[model samples]
Target chain A: MARDTRERLLDAGLALFAGNGLAGTTVSDLEARAGLRAGSGSFYRHFTSKEALFEAVVRQELDRFRTSIGDTTIGESTVADVKIALALEFHEALTTLGQLGQLEAIIHRDAHAMGDLFDEVEGLYNAALDASAARLNQLMESGQLPRRDPQALAVTIRSTLIGYHLNTQSFRRSARRVPPADLIAILIDLISSK
Target chain B: MARDTRERLLDAGLALFAGNGLAGTTVSDLEARAGLRAGSGSFYRHFTSKEALFEAVVRQELDRFRTSIGDTTIGESTVADVKIALALEFHEALTTLGQLGQLEAIIHRDAHAMGDLFDEVEGLYNAALDASAARLNQLMESGQLPRRDPQALAVTIRSTLIGYHLNTQSFRRSARRVPPADLIAILIDLISSK
Candidate 1:
């Protein structure tokens, strides 16, 4: 029961912080939402401070983020296959993190101030870039892709993916959908052209 | 003199807000940084509220954005002319906006709050698309370029440009700079191919 309570607190806190932002949420709100007594001081039992709790949540997510990249093997996939896997990974992360809004909020909140936090975020981005770069390099080595700077090409692909995420958030709320397969196909066509 | 004070306040506010974000700044910080008396209520004299002031500063920059597009006549130029103009515009906007980081911040902060804001941003994006489409349309009509879905082709081209901006921010921080002329040459080669 104690273990369950602690996990519940962490879960509740992540959801709130991701949605309402760091400064906008409080312990009482977490406690109530987690079904703990308002005066029980249970939050203290799990987290000494809100910042500490946030750090825990970030660490948990970062660990998962690292493992996620480790789990994917893009080198073996077709271009379309790689893109679909990546898009699915992003979608899963957003769903698991409670809200897509939370990912943005966390990036905005922690990217500058937290050293480990920023490192983790940059690490995730670079890992994806490296994966994409490797594939491009492979294609080039095999006389598939054109002879261009693989690093530059990889960076361009990654940047477009990030920008798509940044730009799509507004349209996302209206429940409109992007055909990721179509989008990826278009990207692959552009990249593979002569 | 009043106009000078307003300009000073706007400049200080832009630096502070761009560095720290909206919540991290205060009115006193604005006044002190602006070289006015601390807590002198001078900000209120120029602007009614902090949010209002921020909006005005953003608006001022956005007007400059509009002019930047106008000053570069890629939309009405020859194919070669348009390509050269676009390369310059991209280089300038990428360098300036990447350093400030405010344009993206403003879009992230406010793009989702209202449908109109979303539309406004889309307009900014689509204006580029429209410009590209018009040029392509002109080329097709003149038998200089092949006829195709100009709008879709424009979006693809704009998406690629967007991707370039996105990549420069992340991984191309140290690559050899591509001369605008060279970039124009590469793109012109691509378009002239089909």
Candidate 2:
């Protein structure tokens, strides 16, 4: 029941933090929401503090996310294929993240207050970006991708994917949901045509 | 002097809100930082509540941002030129907002708590996107641009510029700043090359 308790704690903590933010949520509140007895020694047995629990949750979610995307498989077959692969990789990464709303809430909450936390989140994002940039550079060097600033391209592709992700994901309004794959194709076309 | 006092109050509130979130800041904090007497009726005369003052600051900042960008003047001389112009406009808009960290803070804080406020902010962003999309449609119709999904390109361009803006502006410790114009050029090339 220990792992179950920790999982429940993470679930409860994520929901509370997303809804009330870090400063607003308390350890007691988390304990109550987790279906654990109040003043139980079980809470401290798993994690030292709420922040530690938060980091655990974030790491778990990110790990799941990276696994979901799998390793980005690129093809040198055509410029179109390369662009599509990049878009697909970026889209999958964002799609996995957007569904949970965990990282979004954390990034938007206490981002200014929690320096190390934000840096960790930002590092994950930038690392993904750096990978894409390096890939772009390799493609350009091989003459598949045209001569373009790989860093800027990496940033552009990422920003495009994130902006798209933010607009569409988790929106509860009555509207058409553009399929993420469709967006990837559109983005690739835009890149390929240019 | 009254107007000057109100301006000072707005200035102080912006600084406080940016440094500490809305919940963390107090009315007394605003008054003290503004150099006004604590618990003075003057605060009530200018604004109904701290939230109202925050709204005013947000609106003023958005308006100032709009004015700073001026009208989107597009010289329909060439496809590349128009794309560049639109990219420049988007970059400038995001740069102005990101520099002050006003909208970013407001969006992060009270985002879940204040639905109407977040909607207003989202509206401003979407409206800007809609305008850009409309312009792209017009250009495409006149054969100035290409026959692509104006909507997708609009979203893509806007998203890319915003993503770039979020990454660079006000990131305290930085080795090199990618001039926003450079980003715009890179984005425009990506589109134009395709």
lDDT by residue (B49-134, candidate 1, tens digit) is: 88777777677766666676676554555546545555665565455456445655555544332334456555665675577678
TM-score of 1: 0.75
Worst 10 residues of 1 chain B by lDDT: B171-180
**True-vs-predicted CA distance for residue B133, candidate 1, Å:** 3.2
TM-score of each: 0.75, 0.78
On the 0 to 100 scale, the lDDT of residue B135 in model 2 is 78
For model 1, residues A92-144, the per-residue Cα lDDT tens digits are 43343334345545665334545567665766767666776776787779777
**Can you write out model 2's per-residue Cα lDDT over A2-74, one digit (the tens) per residue?**
5688889988887877666676677888888898786776689889987888777777766665654345454
User: Between which residue pairs do clashes occur in model 2?
Assistant: A193-B193, A193-B194, A194-B193, A194-B194
RMSD of each: 5.0, 4.4
Candidate 2: deviation at residue B86, Å? 3.6
Docking class of 1: acceptable
